[model samples]
Target: MTDFASEMRTLIEAIDTHNYNYYTLDRPVVSDAEYDKLYDRLVELEQTTGTTLPNSPTLRVGGELLKGFEPHRHLSRLWSLDKTRDKDGLNAWLTRVLKLVGDYNKNNPEQPLPHPTFVVELKFDGLTLNLTYDQGRLVQASTRGNGAVGEGILEQVKTIRSVPLEIPYKDGIIEVQGEGLMFLSVLDQYNQTAAEPLKNARNAAAGALRNLNPKTTAQRKLNAFFYNIGYSDNIRFDNHQEMVAFLKDNRFKVSPDTNYFDSIDDVMSQLEKIGSERLSYDFLIDGAVVKVADMRTREVLGYTDKFPRWAIAFKFEAEEVTTVLESVSWEVGRTGKITPVARVEPVDLAGVTVQNCTLNNIGDIERKNLKHALGSLVYIRRSNDVIPEILGKATEESDGEEIVCPTQCPACGTELEQRGAHLFCPNRLGCRPQMIGRITHFASRDAMDIDTFSVMTAEQLYQECGVRDPADLYKLTYDDLINLDRFGEKKANKLLAAFDKSKECDLSSFLFALGIPNTGKTTTRVLADHFGSLEKVMHASIEELISLHDVGGIVADSIYTFFRDPLMQDSIARMQAAGVQPRAEEKPAAAADESHPFFGKTIVLTGTLSAMSRDEAADRLEALGAKVTGSVSKKTDIVIAGESAGSKLAKAQSLGIRVIDDEQELLELLGLQQS
Candidate 1:
């Protein structure tokens, strides 16, 4: 007997340690070959002994794919926390808690109660997952689908290397509750290869874990952090801090930023700190969770019909301000879509002088219960510090007239067409705004790389030289440029030279410059990669387009319809005649050595680089056969993070992705030593 059981135990422990290092720490001590050797040995021992650990790394290989998830009832119901956006709400709740405690003390005067303390943690904006472990061995995992009955996803749960399959505690059953989350970087990575791109991180996490294919879930790299103990047979704690300590001891990833507040003011201050630092977090946080620290106080407070009385979620308010609605204007986009923009009284918002905000559409106005009256106090919200929007009217009474949508196009005076909730101008040939928008887009940095071009210049050219579209810019002569105001001989020569230089732009940028509806930078790149030429992309059929990954029916139909337009085809032809032929899409570079760290990997660069400019680093990475991307995602294999790197750096750390220090390290990783 070769002590098969003992050997298996040792193997499992070694593999688990490696998994922790690689997956959680992003620091691998052993080579892949060595790790594989250990895994193979474990498999051999397990087969010889006819005993296998539930959390063994070999089980991650998984069995047959599940058809559908079966509904599994949770041992105890999971309740949602009551939410509030105001500090006063917390005060009121705390007052109620004190009243209950005061009554408890009154009944038992001899047993005087001390002051209550609160524990605060970040409330992650993600799906809730309940995990069950029997005798300290991982057994089942389910979603908080209705709080009572949830879909079982044990197979997918096992794919998350962070979740412990087996722990040291071997006494009783414990059900742990955690937030199932996907980092923004991971979601971006998944979208790079997935046929259907996910809308956001939260949705991606939910879809991945709910998927029947454990392989797909594993590839998504879903992560979880335990927050609460839903059901425990033998475990008992006097306070929440002790419970958190136990979870940390068991190697469960809990919130490292949890704080104990002695007073309500202190809790509110902590909430403020949490809200202020929200952008620095790797995962999405909608708010902060405030809970009574004492477990005895929680028991005394008990549960409401839906939420526990002892806990509350303090949601952060949207960055908003009240501004008087001066008027509304409609602007025509390149796609001929007419958008209603709100011209408001100049108010400072997010440190910017705000004037105009999007009204979206008639449906949006209706949904927001807006009267659209001029001079109405409108509530403008800047959510996530992005674009500001007219959330709704602050008051019902207005001093000015009701807003009227334009029946005719704002730019060309053509009759507008209504499609669902959107308004569009069909006069693509004559609309000035449409022409301006399209020409500006075509000359943008991501498009033709016409760095000196501007919308003002585009407008001037269209008005003075009869340059109606992008193709007309290529047709401009020295005389035409010299005739325009502020057009010096030097500027004119530079403009002409830039226009000529744009002909060599890659097929991807050329397609994006076309401004096709439902097409973005990523889609344009994928389309260019698939077709390899402009002609193929323009002539691609709807069915052919839809067959490609990430190209759904809507996008396919839009691209197909755009290419079929006789005007568009004629414009493309005109450009082709003017020596504006774009280069064919380049194939991914082949690496000389497969062992190169950056080879065949997608890398992102962020912040100010001391060794070189961001673009220079990107160029070097691409030269080494690595895909240099603008954003960080789960699909990103490496991030060359530099000084003062913000959210992307935080996200890379959160997902446990490798972050290179400088340009030299990046070059070294690519196996390109400094010459």
Candidate 2:
């Protein structure tokens, strides 16, 4: 065991160094062949030893797709900055800062201070990412989800070429925070071959980082610019300039246009310069951050409940352009909701050319009081780094008629029905868009776990083979697939194998894969657990479904209505005939041992655990007959508290309920072993 450990440590160190050189420095010390050889050896040793370190480089080669993102407690809280757009607001903020500093200096005469220096930086229009490194090796990366907690995206972040996989500073643990963005050039290149082009760079970057597959992010050429240190152990910075310098010294990318200003006027001048030149950069910037550079001054100012008082974001007004609305087209979704898409004359938004934007629905149009006549001018705003949205009417037209809502489904010509504020096409069986969307959802990675299916394949199957539903996917033969465009024998066989593999999925997945209206994964699990069989669920009444804890009246009615459709019943029959029957687990209450500690007990889990993800832990606890609730309440029998546990743990303590700190202890209490 010691020998294996020694070998593993050496391999990890070598691999990490190579990764740092290749990913961070953009220079390869070793050839790809040599690196892969070392990586393969490390993987083999890890498998044999059955022990892997948290910072193992092999984890970057992400395997199975995740069910969903798990919440992670951050080492340091990430706070949002208060924002202002106009000169009046900026001046007011600056005045307040000056007054506060003067007061602080007067109160503390022993610590006389000079005029505060401010660091001005263009705020990159991208998703916030927090990266933590231990002993100079990157360990974890997460999103700024709710300031206190975030979703872990270490695997995806590792694929970003610009982020250093390893750093020179090995003094304890430190956190580097930055924005992850995709450049406009990269976006344009991606759109040329992308199936569905990204709407904007910011959303594209966010979506790529959150994607379950790291390879997808690597392919997108995502980049990052480190700006601040969220946490450090033994490292200190006197000012924000030093922090940026430290980041640059460690081979991490820093913003190229950061400037230090002593006065608000100089800061405002820099902001103007940045705003004017920001459009010329490869990436997007929506605003400039003006921060008190001196760390002492920042500490004196401190923070409010939501934002930092030491800093403020100077936002640029969203670029608005007026263009002629040529036409309004209705697009149908998988759920039968029809969305109004406006086709406008081409106009420049920021730098990208904009010709189309979402008008949302008939209600949105009415709320905006927009004229629906041809050649009428309409205003669109590309705000908050999102796809340009129709803002309001641009012209006080003298003779333009109101845009009339479509009476029929655009795809199947079926008459539309009004549901709440949206219009729906009820032709579930005949509508092409709905059928295609359902097929796509059913074959989605989270549903049946069919990774090889694509929208193009679904379209081909529908048009050529007369396939209308997901169950028909199983009926596809190798010959049939081979006959389709671009499907060779090898591809056909692989697709066939994926279908066969999906049949072995669990009951919850099968239920979710059915594309029932208003039924998400959680609701699907409730139905699967309550019924224990697909047949039972299909026959159960609304009263039975509504009785389940997670299912409400609307969801119950939707489930009841779905099963009552004869067409859906026929599809299920076809699916079963095609060999797609998923095995259901025995009811937890019935199968669980009565002597288990968690038996018939409500449990609440809070914070981060080192042993496994919260989702996995919850599943295990539930298997031991524990009911895992989200919040702490009087009914909570036990609270499994991990590191950095917050309000839920406090609530449990106040209620005098039992709490377990070690995950192993909790597992032992439930008579289970490590997963």
Candidate 3:
């Protein structure tokens, strides 16, 4: 062979190895710049030699846009699994499998099969992909069209870095089945700069794979996890475990969630555990798949008309559902931002009847193709137990009335102003909804911690007592609240006492209570710690505010603009006149001790801590130099799990992060108990 051909071959092999190490193993041996240099050199060599290897990594950049997909027949049928929604249904399926095995064993006592063990895998909520490999080279890729035939999308599939282009098993043809998915984190990143943000990760992946332009698919940054070897000419496995091992051995991206259980009950228990941590996953999963482990047992008990009898899918409660968009109503928030709340036709989703869904803003409405969606079916997703969100229209073609954006504020009829993606009412004082929302937020537990104060109290004070803002709350007298409905002498006095107590709150809580636009609890705390007092924060310039950690230009501008507003300045003056004293947070003595157990660690507290509120614990931990956060992540050093610790604890355990479930141990760390 010529030296040029040999060099090209060497580069191809090296690039492919790097791709396998980076994508499949997720342990890149070289930096991205180093890998790029290798890739660029190979591209240069290919261009000079006028030769591109079939399995070259450069093809992963994507080829010319395809006109349309072509149909490809599979060697083996990709059979679907029968689904069971509840434990009873799963138990019934298991009973049937055991009975079949027993009958077979009775008929052939001399050659009894081993008792069936089950393997459970996550049922990923993404597009099903079937890849065909001939002599270890990826020959074709397709969707699960009809079990036998599928639309070929080889070029699009190549763009997925996780999908192997070539394998070590070079004996003959092989076919593997996996799910194509866009990671939620990747989708969020794409949406940050995308002209029209993708609604959800699943659709982003499926749509990209089906798009005619391979470049579009590459832009989605898709990934896949191979779980099944559907067909193989020169390989055989005695069990599902062996098949999974073979796939992993050939540099396939396999999920670490695959587990084997000897008992059906254990499978159910594992499914429950998976369900708890489902939301914590970067990719979506609607359910779990339970299958017989033994290959011979699967063959003997498989092949129903539509599903594999040996395997069953245990589906969780649906998080996404279609509902009719009845009407759109704008609600003014504490910041005067007008949010479009859609009253959808009541639909059961994720175990609750969801009637209302958020459209986010006018931009979201238009971007999601929901502008003409009134009285039309829309897809609503309720994930992470928050309010359901309207993803997009159920169909591309709309047949309903247009969703008109309100020109005036729905609460006080003030002319609305358009800000980037949202509409806001400039009249912060006269807007009744805005006033009530602001006052209620100010008295919230996380804000001023005013006890006996509720939304009802805010509304009563707003309507009857003439309380227009947070400053107005400080001005309320015993007579002002006593005459209001449901506010007798005792309740009025209690409210007055709570308001008095709230006046002495720390600056962080005070800043948070002000309901500054774009500023959250963490930002308020950071501002308080940096500026030391409300006066300093109010006088801070945009540049000075931006210099603080976590405060961006937008937030700094918001703070500068808010404090300069004449109405806001008057409100602050009124609050000061009414004796609302916001004291600066006490600084920790010297620097935090480096030897402290929780010092300099990022900690997450989940569930109920009986010793103290999570907020109080977070404050104490912060005093000890620990950064307390809400969510569990790979960066988290410790997770303090209390009673009934749910998804966060489950996620921390799954990630192999350290977890402290004992309340006493946590108390010791907080210095509340004798060490």
Candidate 4:
């Protein structure tokens, strides 16, 4: 008989070593396949021998429902901040800090500035939470609700794998303050479904942490970066970087975007640099947290009843300055979908001047029920900085009655229908805006990416050069382009070269460029792969289209509608006429490989899964050939689980869920035979 208990012990020790390697040290010695085998073996022994260990990862991988959130009185009170939103305000804040540091005499408002040191860090856009761990096990997680009475999530907090159920600290009890965040890509993948994706990372973290099911929270991949010491009885760190390094060594993920500054001026420069690098980070970063270096000096400087006087967060304003709306313009998309845009007075944001903000579709305008008219004050926000959105109406008096969606296309005067909140021009053919938008989409880089032609140039070619469609772009001569504004001979030649180069971008970009309604880049990739060529897609029936992954009802409707549109058909005809053919989709890239070890199998992960969450199983499986199917069908190859699996367990039993407990079974199913 295999001494199952001893095997389980060895497996736990090995898996824990790997966890330390990957999550703590940011280095992994073993492949996920190798790790999976060890994990599965441990589970197998534990189940067969009925032996479970303390702080077992299986129990700790996912958090459970909290009894309820309770208020935790701070060791030191958490304080609300006095914020500075712009350059002038930052200068003022610096001026005040210098005064507190005795840069000025009591009577002097303006004096020579004193040399002071500062720290700058990216202000992560996440929900603020205070975590308390007792003897390595997380005891309480509290929200920074109003800087005081935070909702406690005892059970839910346990689900986050990153939040260790136990730590190796000897302080007995350690309280840390940090931010909980989710990745934008995760949110976007979720948004693909009919259900709305989370609006932002902070909200996602807060909501997920508050969920009753530890499994759902586990699936979210919520991670945290410890930044501040809220309370600790015997902890000691010399400086901020020391704290960071120590936390990482002790299993907490630390922010990697931080830098050391020798002086306050250097810190400010770093702050400016953070503004530029903010958009590039994988996690949310709203601004930088600046702190003084020396622990003794920091103690001497002390803190307010709230924040440390030695540290301050320089927050980048996500909201653009108020701009006056000069007009509301309705523009038609290539699909003949009309959207309202607010043309506003230019106001500086971050570093650029803002003018126009999307009102989304007409439905958004009515849902928010914006009441502003020409000359009304409107606030613009680009919280994530891709698209600027109208915050709300700022004026009491209406300049004119609220503008309503037009019943006809302004460009072609075609009859329109109200589909949801959008007013669509049923006459998709020959509508001026629709045709131009189509041309723009076709030329856009995500599509065929004809680099040479721009929307404005396309317009000029349309009205002045008799180029009414995409095929006409290839017919343009340098002499004709040179005749246009900003188009010198050199510029014209470059544009033509780019347009010619677009031929090689592949079928996915080509289909996306077609700009069919609701058919985004991912959908195009799926369609191109399934059909093998653009020609096949053009001939495929709606039923076949619906069978493809991500071809929801709206996309199916759009596919059918686009093919039926004489204008859309004409455009496709012209593209074929001009030799813009979509190539067959290459093999679907495996998210992982044989070292990944489980590519094509269907794994129905249910309940609280130990070792990793259900989501991690699906993610890892997808990387292999393991399709992480949502529901267990008769086809489900494995059902891996943790404690208290409900309906899924019953259904899996009825449908033969191939239930596997512990990690080793899963590893064997994936064919990982560990030593």
The numbered model that scores best in lDDT is 3
User: lDDT per residue, candidate 4, 85-129, as tens digits?
Assistant: 466766676666666656343444454333455556666665666
Choose 3 or 4, whichever is better by lDDT: 3
Q: Using Cα atoms with residue i matched to residue i, what is each candidate's TM-score against the true structure?
A: 0.52, 0.59, 0.51, 0.47
Model 1 Cα lDDT, one tens digit per residue, 1-675:
458777887888999888776765567899999999999999988888787766688777545689998878889877767777888899899988899899998897886566799999998766677999899888999887546667788998888887888877788999999977887778778789989877566656777787788888888787787888888989999999989888877767787778998999999999999989976777777789999999988888898755789999898876689998898888889889988888899887643467988777877777776655687888887553335678888877655567788899988999999986799999988998888999999998878889689999999998999988799998899998997899999999999999999988898889889998877665777788789989889889989998876477878999999999898898899999999887766667555334334567888777656434565666666665777765667887888876546677999999988776533334324322121
Best by TM-score: 2
When summed lDDT is taken over every stretch of 10 residues in candidate 3, the lowest stretch is 666-675
Comparison by TM-score, 3 against 4, better one:
3
lDDT of 4 at 413: 92
Candidate 2 residues 1-675, lDDT tens each?
999989898997898778666755557999999999999999999999899876577665555666767777778887767778867788888788889899988999899556778888878877788999999988889887646667888888977767877788998999899989998999999999999887668667877888877777777888888899999988988888889889978878887788888788888888888777767988988889989899988888888755688899888877788987788888999889999988889988876688888777898888776755556877888644335778877876634556778899989999999998889999988999999999988987768989688888789899999888887888888878888888898898899999999988788888888888877665677777778889999999888987787666888899999999888898889989988887675644548645455678888778666545565677777776778765577877889987547677998889999787644344334332232
Ranked candidates, highest lDDT first: 3, 2, 1, 4
Q: Candidate 2 vs candidate 3: which has greater lDDT?
A: 3
The C-alpha stretches of model 2 lying farther than 4 A from their native spots are 1-119, 126-283, 300-309, 312-317, 348-351, 398-404, 472-495, 529-532, 539-544, 547-550, 584-675
Superposed Cα RMSD, model 3 = 26.7
Deviation in angstroms for 348 in model 3?
16
Clashing pairs in 2: none
Badly placed stretches (over 4 Å) of model 3 are 320-675
Model 1 scores a TM of: 0.52
Candidate 1 colliding pairs:
185-633, 185-634, 186-633, 186-634, 189-635, 195-550
Determine which window of 10 residues in candidate 1 has minimal summed lDDT. Answer: 666-675
